[model samples]
Target: MNEQHPPGPAEAPGFWLDTPEHRQWLMSEAERQWTFFAASLRDGPGFFSLDTAGNPLSDDTQELHSTTRLIHAFALGQISGHAGADRIVEHGMAYLRDHHHDAEHGGYLWALRGDAIVDDRKLAYGHVFVLLAGASAKMAGHPDADALITDVSDILDKHYWEEDAGLFADEWNRDWTPFSTYRGMNANMHAVEALLTAYEATGQDVFLSRAGRILEFFTARIAPAENWRLPEHYSQDWEIDRSYAGNPMFRPAGTTPGHSFELGRLLLQFWDLSGRQDRNMPVTARHLIERALKDAWCAHGGLAYTLEFGGKVSASTRFWWPVTEAIGAVAALIKLDRQASDEQWYRKLWTFADTHFIDHIRGGWFPEIDNAGQVTSTIFKGKPDIYHSVQACLFPLTNGLSGHIDDLKHSEPVAMR
Candidate 1:
């Protein structure tokens, strides 16, 4: 079904997220999540575990991705002047330096169970987040920020980057000897995000150049060729892998509409950061956002998890992340075009989120929901992390996309409670 907004009154001069009421609400919500996550911290190694109801679960293995994400989130908290945020950021940084990093292997191991390597593979997905965490930490004035950023950047350049391909390889063994031939847009998409943050943090030309190349490959070339239903899996040579489905949660089969929304917003950020030279960037971003909404929005309400390349729904399950990404995508589009339909989408998506995904009493978003908008645990359970939802609240309030949250100048003040 085609989703379009009916003609309505012109939206006010500024974005909704910049308004005092929304800013206050977003900050309050972010603080609530921060308090929830801060409660899960374990002291010895300073790592968090999988959590349910603001408490860590029985899983002892600390995931690199979630740990890095929490660090990044807390770093944002530091930027906002939230009390106790620095301690959380420092705790996460210590975990990354002392626990996650492989000094001999030259990159981070994927997961750890109490100093024993649970999964030692070096994944591009995990490493990109390391870059992001470093950037955020640096922005928040962490003492070891420069070292973390430099180490991750050098490691990425040395191990993962294919200088000729302008894209990253997927994974490698712990000692960095054997490499996986598999390639993926998911990793590269996140690489662009990290690269942009790196460039902003260090003012490096190479990071920006690499980001542009990746955007050109995925947003300019492949996405348009595939009619904006981006293919996720790829071969070593970057050929589409239609039948390969590796992990149900991370590397699922078919196109992820959530990713399309995320790429849409990232492309716009790149366009602005690159001085708006590439006219196709915003155009491609709009196409991606519109196509994702049209193809993936479940008739019952929220977005479906996955869709075939031909625009058919492959997984009808609705998850919280996609909707949050959609909110950011539409917000970016609204800033560019200020179309009434986009504004309608922005408001509509937040309404859907508040009605379904948010946990009013528990204080965090439900990670997964069914098509009927009922909470579900089929794919994820109990608020794994707060990265996506917090960003959805934060990004729209920024004055520009040049840097991390710490670099963003608040467009409006938080309303007095």
Candidate 2:
């Protein structure tokens, strides 16, 4: 007979993620991931590989979004007193400034292959991450962060922000001559995250105002009108394009349940940041979270990647990022209401993640898993970076979504050692 291991302390009664031991465990796991990525860093102009395990695939192309996320994550590590965190942050910052920056163009390029520009399109999604990285680095006391933040903000305002539409344009050519007619909620959602951080880092009201505008449009108007099933793609005129389907990975067809969960969390964060003035925000957030959970949560385990607007599963495959976002969504609801149902959903999501996504031997999450709870990499392979998983661990441990994790004063002392 096999000997059984006792349930861990995290499974104990009332031992939510905010508990001291759990928070410490999250910090330790974050450090583990940081170390893994740090060891894989490619020097010479400073960039990171796409995957961390087994020969490091996609070592030639460096994605600007991934680079910025790594910078932001490592900056958090730096603030937490991790030893090599600052070095990684510095390396990523140098890469962003020297390599990713388009000298002839106003904005950063999409990706780089060695010294050559590969995908030079200017994307709102990538640009928002640039803002986020700069803000996080600034919070972590990086020397060049202020200048980076200023430059990225200027660029966003000049190219991405649509003053007339009160939203952001999706993409543009390298020279900013040809702008895509496509408008997307994904990029705008990330823009909300970046703008919130920018406001926190600089205390600028303009950033906050812009963030509020995006939130109001999506949460207050669009989500409510659509029965909380937010559309992902839109035309240049901001009309929903039901027929538009781009990349299966990034621009999947149909409504993304993951985005609903993410937008729910961001709405709550924005509401909290705005002094809780918007009474409708918490209500809207709850609806979005519940809609996704009802429609996307796989009957067997995990969540479906995409769903039809009427709550039918579009993509039956499960990915790690959606589950992480669902964890965050329920965590935010728990913070807002402390309802027993919210707590139950939170525990359920964590259980799903631990069972399917977590790689017990490898020390990081698997990026994708099938509905049967078996590991699969049809879309994403080899633990693409720790940004989503680390944040899934960190966000629940915090009191509110204000500023960067480094700047917030946790209710329990963060185990930084």
Best candidate according to lDDT: 1
Task: Report the C-alpha lDDT of model 2 over 170-261, residue by residue, as the tens digit.
Answer: 89899997667999999999999888888888889998999999988888888888889998999888998989899998898889989999
RMSD of each: 4.4, 2.8
lDDT of each: 0.82, 0.80
Q: Over 4 Å off in model 2, which ranges?
A: 1-11, 50-55, 404-417
What TM-score would each prediction reach against the true structure?
0.93, 0.93
Please report the TM-score between candidate 2 and the true structure: 0.93
Give the clashing pairs for model 2.
Answer: none
Candidate 2, run of 10 with poorest lDDT: 1-10
Error of 2 at 406 (Å): 4.5
lDDT of 1 by residue, 1-417 (tens): 212222122354556655665556666666666767777578777565545577777677788998899899888888877678888899889989998999886889899887788899999999999999998888889999999999999999998999898999889999887677999999999999888888877888998899889988988889889998899999989999999897887999989999999888888888888899878778899999999999998877899888988999998888889999998888788767878788778877887887788776667788887656678798665678789988887777665554546444332323212
